[model samples]
Target: MARMIPDNEAKEILVLYYSQHGATRQMAQLIARGVEQAGLTARLRTVPPVSATCEATAPAIPDSGAPYATHADLEECIGIAVGSPTRFGNMTAAMKYFWDGTSPLWMKHALAGKPAALFTSTGTLHGGQEATLLTMMVPLLHHGMVLVGLPYSEPELTSTQSGGTPYGASHHAGVAGELPISEHERKLCIALGKRLALTARRLNA
Candidate 1:
């Protein structure tokens, strides 16, 4: 079992996500940066990609990027920021699968009342960015997490032609995932991280 720790000592927020083709992963890193900018630790974690064969399984440890997330990470963190690429106006199967395994946490009310945030990446501007974000909120809501979204006061929400939304931070990757993260999208991502970190801090305080 993981060692017990008081909430006062859990001064970090979790930036948990799953990325394919790397766009969502880049956004996750930016969010983690923003979280640190808010003066709290950001615990970066990722879920293993799901495979078709029930016989197939990922190695216990990932070869690179953030480590595979553990339930303890969720239990210890004061807040959470989850991300994933769009999958038909909803979260990817991998992200949904990971959340599905958290029934134990839900039974414990482990995430209730904690601050939560969301982000996503899509292949096209009209590719269900808002829908994915909104749907992503369902599981968090079921966990009784308090959702936080971007407010229009953030100037980029009004100006970004690419990908900044009041729903949450987002990025518009090209069809082949060739386009780089735009300045506006990057700003919104960082802003989200900062906001999530700040909210987690206050909740813990």
Candidate 2:
């Protein structure tokens, strides 16, 4: 049976991502903070690592931190914020694999009309952060979610030297995660989350 999210309960926002070196994870948390700031519940979830040689199974539950995202998480959330580190100007294979498995939900229109946003981190200044963010949106678009992006009106979009784009929020992690997220990048992430949550609430109403 398909799980149902109760109308009476507070709207839930799912912050899902696959972080290789923790920078993406930090971005997810920052986004979650913004979701909470908008008075919505944020459920943080992560995807398991994928194997290249053969099909591998992760334990039913993760060893620590957020549980691996189940299809139910996508169905239960009124909004979604997805993040990943750039892999040759695209989302990592692990993250892409997770989305590829969501065809069932896509067919069911489970996420239709929900508010969604994307984020990404890159190793260098020109390391395809925007392309990565844009590519990540493809699957979400197929699922019928509304794409929310940072608008040029956000002052940081104009002032940001490290990472900020109209496509979505982003961070330049530098080589080996040496660089911290800039003030502009952090604020933009929070803003994206808040915008998604607020949009979800308004849509639900």
Candidate 3:
């Protein structure tokens, strides 16, 4: 465990993400497991995909994986782990759309002082993993959440040749997004999640 689990532990860390090819979604699942490893509950959630046609709509509930997140999830979670598939050196439009609807929480400072972490998956090794992660942090910063990231102290950070960064966890999903996460990349994802959850526990304790 990253830290001693409080006897009265009640708060959870929200593991929210948008995935196109299931790679980012897998990362979110691993992150949530890591959060639970650190003794805090993890709330797995997802955002629906967007469409070019304004008239198109997503179902009220997702068909599989996790349920769609609500503003209440943001308000209730002690911390958050956000993930997205990189899109042209930035976050996906679906993920952005989710944040765009969070103005009400922003106004209430609902996420202020909470800890947040980021994760991303890209089709190639040089597909803007860092840029996507950095840009993803912008809105969380506006919400006044503390940012958490993997440090070099994590052995995988120094040894991993595939995907890992101080900015956040990352995965190389191949051009077709068919690659499974590498061993080192998986460890880093879990590490980042534990780090974020530990921070949340400390602050909330």
Lowest lDDT 10-mer window, candidate 1?
1-10
Candidate 3 lDDT over 67-141, as tens digits, reads: 999998888788899999999888988888889899998887778888999999999899999999999999999
Instruction: Put down candidate 1 lDDT per residue, 1-205, tens digits, no spaces.
Output: 2223365574888999998899999999999999999998899999988876422157889988899998888988888999999999999888888898899999888888888999999999899999999999999999999888898988988999998888899999988899899999999999999999888777665
- Report the C-alpha displacement of residue 104, candidate 1, in angstroms: 0.6
| Global lDDT scores for all candidate models | 0.89, 0.89, 0.89
Q: Model 2 over residues 1-205: C-alpha lDDT tens digits?
A: 2234477876789999988889999999999999999999999999988778434457768888888998988988888999999999999888888898898888888888888999999999999998898888889888888899988888999999999889989999999998999999999999998988898888887
| TM-score quality measure for candidate 3 | 0.94
Clashes of each: 0, 0, 0
